[model samples]
Each structure stands twice: as C-alpha cells, then as structure tokens.
Target: MTVANGSEPKDNGGVTPPGDVTPSETPDNRPSMSDLAAGYAGKAGLQRNSAGHVDMLKSAGGVQGIAESILPGLVFLVVFTFSRDLGPSLIAALAAAAIFTVVRLVQRRPLTQAVAGVVGVGISAWLANTTGKAEDFYVLGFFTNIAYIAALVVSIAIKWPVAGLLFGFVRNEGLDWRKDPERLRAYKLGTWIVVAVLALRLVVQVPLYFMGEAGLTALATTRLLMGAPLYILGLWVAWLVTKPAAQPSKPSSSAD
Candidate 1:
C-alpha cells in the first residue's frame, strides 16, 4: 500500500526503510555519519521550548550551569585584582569549581558539566601557577577557541556544515535538509555565524592575552562576557536564519 508520501510501504516487519535505517541495524552496530552528527547536536545542549523556538537559557545549561561557567573566572579576577597574587586567585577559582561539583553531587544531578568545569578550572590554575603569570590562566581558552573554529571551518569545507547537523536535528528536518540546495546554503551561512563568534573571541581576547598582567582584568572581564552569553547569542541567530520554510499544504480532492 502507498503511504502518505505516495511511496509503497516496505514489508520487512516494520523495519525502517533503507534511507531511515540507523547504524544500530548494521552488523558492527557502528554509528554512521548521521548518527555521529546527531549525537554531537544532542550533546551541544540546545533545547526547544514548547513553542518550538530554541531556548537560549537552557542551551547555556540553565542558571546553575551558567554560574558554574562564570563564577570561577570571576573569582579569579576579583581575587587577583585585590590581592595581586596569583596563588590565591587560582585557588579561589579552583574552589569555585569544586563547590559547584559538590553542589551537583548533593543534588544528584548529572555530574558531567560540573566535573568538566572543575577539570577546566584545575587546568587553568595549573597552567597559570606553573607559568607564574596570571594571564596564562586563560591560555587554555585560546586553544579551545582555535580548535572549535578549525573544526567548524573544516565541516563547512567538506559540505557537512555543523550548523546543518545541529539545527536540522533540532528542527526535525534530519539529514533531508542536505538534499535541498537552499537549505544547504542557509545552513552554511548559519555555520559561518558560529565561526564568526569563535573567531571574534580570538580576535578580541588574544590581543589582551599578550598584554600580560597589565591587561588581566580586562581579559577576564571580556572572557566572562563573551563566553557563554556570546555563544548563545550567535547560536540563536544561526538557528533563526537557518529556519526551514513552511511546506505548502497539498490541496485535497473531493470524492465523486
């Protein structure tokens, strides 16, 4: 029997059509490119509200998550500014991260974000302490931005724009959007928007990083402002611009 799309239905005991089959059906059960892309999008923490719009706050990991991300850097900046001591500044930052981890544990929530925050803070602290330069605390962030920009650019170059993989799944378009030239172009533009965000961070922050301890306060402040908040703004814009056009409804036929 023909389905709603006017295609004959398969008869493999309700198995998904070949085009829709996921990697789990394969002999090795290895994930396909689509599965990998979808998993990346899922882990990105982007969420949709009941209205079907991207929830920016939720995507930034809610209030607690935002605090977890910002508190450490803010503590480091404040402590360093007042005491002019790298040791106490690093310790305060690490303490903030640890406190968040403890809070997550007490609440029995998923520890991934908390644990990652702690690790990142620890690395930053270690790097700064080892270098005996407070400015070095943000070095890790520079590398992170570079890595993300590189990956996003490569995805665009390969024509598998990360924005398409991400928003396509979020919007329920799946991989089908790749088949539409207009959708593909829109997604490419979306990917470039994200790329611009990452590049902007480097362009603005890397200069401050070279200014050494003299620019530490400004560097930390900008880092806090441009971190999650800037990222969410860019992602929101990308999501909006890449939105799929509404499908035209087919006219119904009257029965004779």
Candidate 2:
C-alpha cells in the first residue's frame, strides 16, 4: 500500500512510524538516545544550507561579544603598565567588567558575554592577589588553553571529535552526521583548527611567563592578542570546513 506522500506504507501491526505518532503519544513513544541522535543527524543531512550553523555561532557570541570579552583584560593591562601595581590593576579590571555589565544590562543585551568577562577577570585577579605576583594574573588563561587543547586532542583520539559533538549538539544535528565520511572529515578538520589556536596561545605565552619576560604588561598583551581574535578565526575555519557537507545533496539527473 502507498502512503499519502508516495512512500510505501508500513506493514506493522497497527504501529505507526515514529513521525506519524501523535504528539500526545510521545510519552508512550519516548525516543531512545540512539533515536534522538539519529533524528538530530537526519536534520543536518536534510539541511540545504549552512545558515543554522552560522546562527548557532552567532548565538554563542559574535564580533561585538568578542570585543566585550577582551575589554576587561585590556583595561587591566593598561592600568598595570603605568602603575606596575597588582592591586590597582585588579581593581581596574574588575571595575571595567562591572561597567560593561551595567551597559549591557541597560541596553537589554544578552548577559552571557558580560557575565563571563567579569568572571574571568575576577578569577585572574584572585590568582594574582593570592600569589603576590603580577605575572600570575595570566596563569588562569594559560592553563585554561592547555586544558582545552588536551580535551580536543583526546576527543579526536577517541574517534569522536569534541568539536563535532559540540557543533552537532548546538545545532541539534544528531550523530547521523558521523555516518557520512565527508561530514565527519569536515568536523575533524574544524576540531584541528581550534586545537591549533589554543596551542598557539600556550606556545607564545608560556615561554614568556617562565622566562620572566612576560611581566604584567606583555602577558596581558599576549592574552589580549591571542584571546578572542584567534578564537574567532577558529570559529570561521570550522564554519568554512563544515559548509560543504551541510549543503543538501543535489538530485541526480536522469538520462536525456
């Protein structure tokens, strides 16, 4: 028997196809993790463009968000450069973050970026204060990047790239994408790009930190330069790599 959409009708004993199950029946037809994953993957496979993925990236934080992210660090660096004092520098950074948060609140903008900026500044300041060294302010960032790089590497080593899983989760794209060799390859490449950026930050800043050459000013500068800017590039690279695979497959032409 043919279904209304021209597909063959199922021969099950009165059991409907999953999609045909009514919303009211969801409780009785609760999908398994594998089913959910398949649905997510199927959606991505059906997409005709990369717009959804782009929107997901924008929602996380766009260029303006990135600017907001680095503002507190920039303020700290400038203040420390002149005073060479940890206390004042910490206050300045925190104050800047507070002001940014207030501005965002006033504008009714998303608080995710502002809140995160403030938290990061607070952590760095606390580290510097506890350690009694101005250079220690950068410690949090260095280790954070190391952890990220390690996680990405391990995810890839396990044959499940962290970047891909995140992208899928964010976009509601399921594990089905992994079944496609091309899409999977694109995800792997994207993961590598992110790893490269994180590694670059550590490679440049770690030496300076240990050698005492970074000081407060140079370390701040390095952190600012490597922070949101490099991350944005990585985001772009991921988007670019996955764009092709996200495009819908073109219909094959019949013989003329």
Candidate 3:
C-alpha cells in the first residue's frame, strides 16, 4: 500500500459544464426588444413614455426632438411659406422629404428612424387635404406651428447638432463632412436664402390676410398647413439641392 500510494490519483470521471442561458432565466439584466426600441423612438420623438420622459413627443422637449428628426422639413417650411400657391409648396416639400429619406437609406441609418420622417409627411398631407378651414385641422396646425417654433429655437440654441448630424451622414458617404479651416461662408448662403424666403412669406401674407382669404393667409404664414403633397415635393428638392462643398479656394501661384 505504501508503494502504490507513491503515485498521484488518476482516471477520474469527466465533469459536466453549465448550460446556455435561456430567455426565461437569463442572468443578464439586458432590456427586451420593446424597451430598446422605445429608447430609440424616444430619441427621435416617435414614441413617448407614460410618465412621458421616455417619449419626446410626449415630453416638454419633444418638439425639438421632432424638429431634429427631420431637418429638410424645416427647410421646406421656409421654402413653402413664401410660395404663391399651396399646391407647388406641397410638391416642393414632398420632394425635400423624399431626399432626406433617400439620404438615410444610403447612409444605412436605422430603418425605424427613416420611417418616422414618413409619419411627419403623413401629418402634413392630412393637414393640406383638410385645408386650414377645418377646425380640427387648424388645431393640428396650431400644434405643428408650435413644433416649428420649438425646433427653430432649438436649432439656434444648439446650432451644431444639425450640422453635426449632417456631416456625420456625409462622412459615411466617404466625403469629409467637415471643412478644414472651417469657414462660415458656405453656411451664410443658406442663411441668406432662408432670410429672403421668410421676407417673401411675410410680404405675401399681408395682402392675403387683409383680403379676408383666411386660408390663403394660413397658406402663406403656415406654409400650407394642410398640404402634404407639397411637403413631399419640398423634401425631394432639399435632397436634390445637396450641400455645398466644404473646400476653400486655393491661392494661385505667382510663378506664372
């Protein structure tokens, strides 16, 4: 027994391993699909929570979320407000919205995020179809107006957010979204365009409001609150306009 005990014990039975975690009893406290999706929808103002901090549209800050959700729509609003007819304005808006949608697709952004833009377009269209005369539509327009104002305020307050989002998408396209030297000259042009359109909107509104054509005035001031077809058109156009190049002009050589 003393000689046999000199060697170490060997040939023991194999041990079994633990099984994979199942959905019913997973140890990790990760969120489920609905919870994760709700978080994302909250970011874009597509959905809100019960206490409402979870959903942007439901939250006090949701209007900005909506505005940030669709950049081209705001730009389209600027364009539409100045146009003579709701029909053309709606067309233009739709054009711009379409482009924004395409850019999202090309960039491979989240599918749900892209669809949220579609929801805005639908609302715009319903308003256009009902026209400003409908009481319910006017109510909707009131809220939409609030959304625009809120967005405008947010864009100004957090000015870089929009540009950052844009350049982020552009960078994905393999183009350097940011300019070297970062001059504001290019952005100035868009600013001027918005100013001119805003003035035009005001100019048109004066006569329409005075003439007693309330719908026309609403069309001018609110940019066809009920005109969805035009919204789609505008979205398409915005996509087409394309961002101006970020490159600065190079100095010519004096050797010539």
Candidate 4:
C-alpha cells in the first residue's frame, strides 16, 4: 500500500461500515482514526527507502537532527562536569539548542524539531536552576518515559497496540491488521518491545538520578546513550520481528 509522491493511494477494497461517516461527510472535517494513525506512523521515525529497506538514520531525522537532539545535553554535561557551575552549564546547553533553532530559521526549514529542542533545553535549564540541583535537569525525562510506557501498556491491553498503529501504517497494512489474530499478536509483542526500552531507561537512570549531584555525570551520559540510539535499536528489532510472513507463490499453469 505504498503511496508514491503526488499520487493517490489505490483502494485496498476496504468497506466503510453502515452509518459510519467518511472524512468528507464529517461535520467538522476532522480526520478519522485511520488518518491520525497514518500521520503518527509517518513521524514515528521509521521510513522505507526507495529500495524498500528501513532507513533508520533517515527516519531518525538524519545526522543534523541526531546532533540537535544530543549536543545540548552533551554540552551541559561537559560544561558542568568541569566548571561545577550550573549557570554557565545551563547557558551553554541553551545556546546549543538555540543555535539549532536559528539555523533552521535561517535555512527557512520547518521549525518543529528545532523549536522543540529549544523548548526542552529551556525546561531542563529552568528545573535545574530553580532547584539548585544539577540532577533535576533530568527529572522531566523520567516522567516522559513513564508516560510512554503507560500509554503503550494501555494500548496493548485495549487490543489496539501502539505498534500496530505505528508499524501497521508504515507497512501499508492500515488498521486491517487488527482483524488478523496473528498480526495482532505480533503487534502486541512489538508494543512490549517498545515498553521494555522505555522501562530500561527508568531502571538504569532512576538510581543514578537518586544519587543526587554526585551521580550527575553518569546519569547524563546514560541518558544520552539510552535516548535516541537505544530507541532506534529497539524499534528496529521490533519491526524485524513483527514483519508479515511472505505468501507462498502460486504455481504457473501448464500449457493446455
């Protein structure tokens, strides 16, 4: 169900249930659940290249995006480790994020990721500065991981796994995969794979977080390592495991 650029998707012969309003027929023209799922999959940091292979780096937003995500925290960790000054460390981190935002603005590119980086850096700086504890900078990350784990668990419990919504759409299976028990089970497993990754972060970092100022460097380093890189690895593994089995090819007819 791959859709090419500037082309309409071919119908997969799906039928809308009776009394169900299509997107066009909706009063406010709000997108359907399927539409929302598709949009999420597109941004889930998983993409198939022209060769039909998953291009993890491209999906992770290329080299520039990866640097934008890591450098601010890296800057903070390095500066604070040497100077032991929260003020300068926070400024350096904020500057790193702000530089990315400025580059995006100057390049006339979409500001979504860059602006998000700036906002996240700003919050971490504020939390650490206000509490006068360098460790507080990572407090928000703990809550974020817990929230995602909870969401994924809930989705699996409801039998509409997050991985199904994400990977199913990316694979062009749409919501139809939910009707297949085998695929449904595979997606549930995939969702748990994601849950494990998020859980691993909390398990490893929370203890270091509790160590207070003394554990700042280890906590920061672990956070950077387990952040995007771990996520990509987990997602890749889940995707590979959940892939649909290939159908057996039919034999050709003999000449009459």
Residue 199 in candidate 4, Cα distance off native in Å: 0.5
Model 1, 161: alpha-carbon shift in Å? Answer: 0.8
Lowest lDDT 10-residue stretch of candidate 2:
1-10
Superposition TM-score, candidate 4 onto the true structure: 0.87
What's the lDDT for all of these models?
A: 0.83, 0.66, 0.38, 0.81
Q: What is the C-alpha local distance difference test score of candidate 4?
A: 0.81
State which candidate, 2 or 3, has the greater lDDT: 2
lDDT of 4 by residue, 109-207 (tens): 778889999998899999999999999988989998999999899999999998887777556677888889999999999999999999999999999
1-256 in candidate 2: lDDT tens per residue?
A: 1112122232212222233432233465454443433343333322222434444334335566766777778877788788878799899989988888898889998676688778988998998899887777778888788888888888788767755655654454546557777778878888898899888888888877876624556767878888766776776677677655446889999998
Q: Give candidate 1's TM-score.
A: 0.87
lDDT, residue 183, model 1 = 97
Local error of candidate 3 at residue 70 (angstroms):
5.0
Off by over 4 Å in 4: 1-22, 25-30
Clashing pairs in 1: none
**Residue 22, candidate 3: how far off, in angstroms?**
7.9
RMSD of 3: 20.1
Rank the models by lDDT, top first: 1, 4, 2, 3
Per-residue lDDT tens digits for candidate 3, residues 1-256, read 0001112221101111122122233235443332222223234322223432122233322333234344444544455456645556555656666665676678775555446555665576567656642222223444554455455345435432222222222222211322432322333333333333434444544444445444543544354432333333332233233354657989988985
- Name the lDDT value of residue 178 in candidate 3: 27
